[model samples]
Each structure stands twice: as C-alpha cells, then as structure tokens.
Target: MIRGRITGSVVSTRKLINLVGSKFMEVEYLRGGVSESLIAVDLVGAGIGEEVLVVTGSSSLRALEKDAPADAVIVGIID
Candidate 1:
C-alpha cells in the first residue's frame, strides 16, 4: 500500500468495457512529507484534496476487475 493525497480526477468516454463506470483520481504520492502526483483508480468515493491509501499489483487488479481496468486502486480514504 502507498499513502497519498487526491489531487484531481480523470474522465474517459472511450474506455474498455470493464472501466466504463469506474472513477479515476490523480493522487500525489507521499513519503514522509514529500509527494509526487500520479493516477489511481477510485473504487471508494474519494474527493479531490482528500488523503487516501492505494493498493497495487494483484490486489489492485482484483479490485479493478470488478468494474474496470485498474492498475492502481484506491483501497481507503485516510483522514
């Protein structure tokens, strides 16, 4: 898992069948106090500027496979 802050959102009209109804957000990856923005899938309802936890690899794949193609999935919203 990785810790990050939601930075923005992604909107796609033409996507794979699995990804039609999924929400995507851009997260600023964080380590300590530093961060770098990257894209992630939002299965959980996360808004921009919220802190969140992300899952990658097989865990991410499984979560994304539920509704869309996900390489990185938001697993939790952090307070």
Candidate 2:
C-alpha cells in the first residue's frame, strides 16, 4: 500500500461497465515528505483533504479485478 493525500476528484461521464459507478480521486503521492501527485481510482468512499492508502497491481486486481484497467484504487482512509 502507498500513502497519499486526496487532492481532488475525477469525473468521467463515460466509463467501462465495471467502472460505471466507481469514483476516482486525484491523490498526491507522498514519499520522503515529497508529493508525486498521482491520480487513482476509489473503490471506497474517500474525500479531498483526506489521507488515504492505495493498492495496485494484481492485488488491486484481485480486490476489484485486473480487467477493470485501473492503475490504482483507494483501499482505505487514514486518520
């Protein structure tokens, strides 16, 4: 899992069937106190300004499906 802060929300009027109802958020990836500013999909409900944990790769695919074509997914919210 990776740690990051939610910066904004992503909007797509048209998306894949699997992603039809899913939400995506822009996350500023943080490491060593620096931000990478990456965007990720949100399977769980997370809001801007909130710290979040993200999952990727096959593990993420297992959680949501690899065929979904998502690079990242918000797995949890951190206080």
Instruction: Tell me, by TM-score, which candidate is best.
Output: 1
Candidate 2, poorest ten consecutive residues by summed lDDT: 58-67
For model 2, the local distance difference test gives 0.82
Q: lDDT for every model?
A: 0.82, 0.82
Quote the lDDT for 27 in model 1: 88
Q: Candidate 1, residues 1-79: lDDT per residue as tens digits?
A: 8888898998989988877778889988866767677788887898998989999766787765655566788989987
lDDT of 2 by residue, 27-46 (tens): 88867877687678887789
The true-versus-predicted C-alpha distance at residue 17 of model 2, in Å, is 2.4
Winner by lDDT: 1
Q: Model 1 — TM-score against the truth?
A: 0.82
